[model samples]
Target: MTNWDDFRLVLALARTGAIRQAGAALGVNHATVSRRLADLTRRMGGAVFERISGRYQVTAVGAPVLEAAIRMEAACLEGERRLRAVSPDMAGPVTVSLPDAIARVVLLEELTAFAQANPDISLTLKCSYAYADLDRSDADIVIRGASAPDEHLVGRRLFPYALAHYCARDYFDQVALPDRRWLVRRTPAQWIERSPCPEAPVGYVIDDIDMLHEAAARGQGMIRGACYIAESDERLIRIPGSKVEPWEDLWVLTHPDLRDAPRIKAVMGLVTEALMRSRALIERGETDRCRG
Candidate 1:
């Protein structure tokens, strides 16, 4: 009888392409990966890996074992998702991931209300720019900016926004609109071209737009501010005569596997409803952030 442990070891080693790398990926020491390999070989009467210059490579004999292992992992993950969806009680951790900006303002507040409403369901969160792996259980839900969604999951529209140029009043008066001190997003900075002098065409490049907005508000530089932000901050004023544009779409996404589960359904419905409360304004970026 083959166990999941045996299958996992073989697959991890093969996928990593080296025992040491596999060990690192699995959070185990190289010796443990090596010992497991020897144990499995003795039990199955097969050499699963060939050592070449201290690196272990999967052998032809091991390929089938690795294939089986991958299938097993998929089955197990799907089974877990199913169990979560169908649990009789709507109580357990429902992890959500998002970018820090959304996490701080909308998702966090909505999640707080959800936790209050569904007292039994706990909300866990992660904030990052990197996408969470839904298939691997990194998060049960995600809210982020997207042009489109993955075919494997279901996504609901959260909002649309207009992006406009804004700067702190003091910075605008001192730095000039096209000066190097003007805060700009990475792509636009490169597109606009760099100039060394203050009078020369230049912009401050920042990867995080949310942070860029905050910096601009603090008089550090100028940047693209979400319309929701501009409407509220008197200190931050939009650049005169500069055309702004619609930003990317925002989405709340989850695996279809949990759609039927009561807890997941409850939370998903709540979030969708809360975001939609500002539907008209969010669609056009015509309302203030607080109102939305």
Candidate 2:
């Protein structure tokens, strides 16, 4: 009988190149990962990996087995998700991934209240602008602002949010607005069509949102951001009558396994409640910021 569960241990060690990295990702102690790796080596008859100069490398014999090990890894994840889906009442930990802006502006402040009410539930928040892997169970839930994601996800609309340009009041007051000294994204020419000046930004273009946002925040230069974020932060003030694009939906998504879990529902409801409370600022940005 083959223990494919042991193969997952092999794959994790193989990809991570060291026992420590694999342990961190799998949330186990280094000693436990080491023990499992040793246990797995014996059953496989020949050594699967060799440590050379502080790096783990797969042997030629082990290389061919990697493809099959990966398939077992996928099956193990699917099985875990299925068990979690079936066990609706169990709760211990749930992980959520979202952008730093949203997490800081909203979730961080209110999580304490939820924690007090549900003492048994522990929440882990991962802050990143990148899309986390739901298939790998990177997070049990995620908040995203965009169109839809892959067909496998179970997602729901929280609300539609608007985008707008903002700058520190003092910056605009001192330097003057739209004088070609500001930071700009090379969006479609249609985006440049409605600037306060007949001549739009001629230089100093930055494409990354974080750089553009930091420039605007420090009053170095101006850039656009989601209204709910820019308006909530007292550090930034919206530039009224600026161009407004159409609103996009903010989503709460989870693997289908968690689609009906009570604790997941409670946390998501808290987030939706927060969004509703922010509705006034969201709408104000849409009306006050659109130029044409």
Q: Against the true structure, whose lDDT is highest?
A: 2
- CA lDDT scores, all candidates in order: 0.71, 0.72
Specify the poorest-scoring 10-residue window by lDDT in model 1: 191-200
TM-score against native, each model: 0.79, 0.70
Candidate 2 lDDT, 115-153, residue by residue in tens: 887787888889887898888888888888767777788
Q: CA shift at 123, candidate 1, in angstroms? A: 1.4
Worst 10 residues of 2 by lDDT: 283-292
Candidate 2 Cα lDDT to native:
0.72
Give the C-alpha miss distance for residue 245 in model 2, angstroms: 1.9
Residue 163, candidate 2: C-alpha displacement in angstroms: 1.0
Off by over 4 Å in 1: 14-21, 38-59, 176-179, 182-205, 228-235, 279-283, 288-292
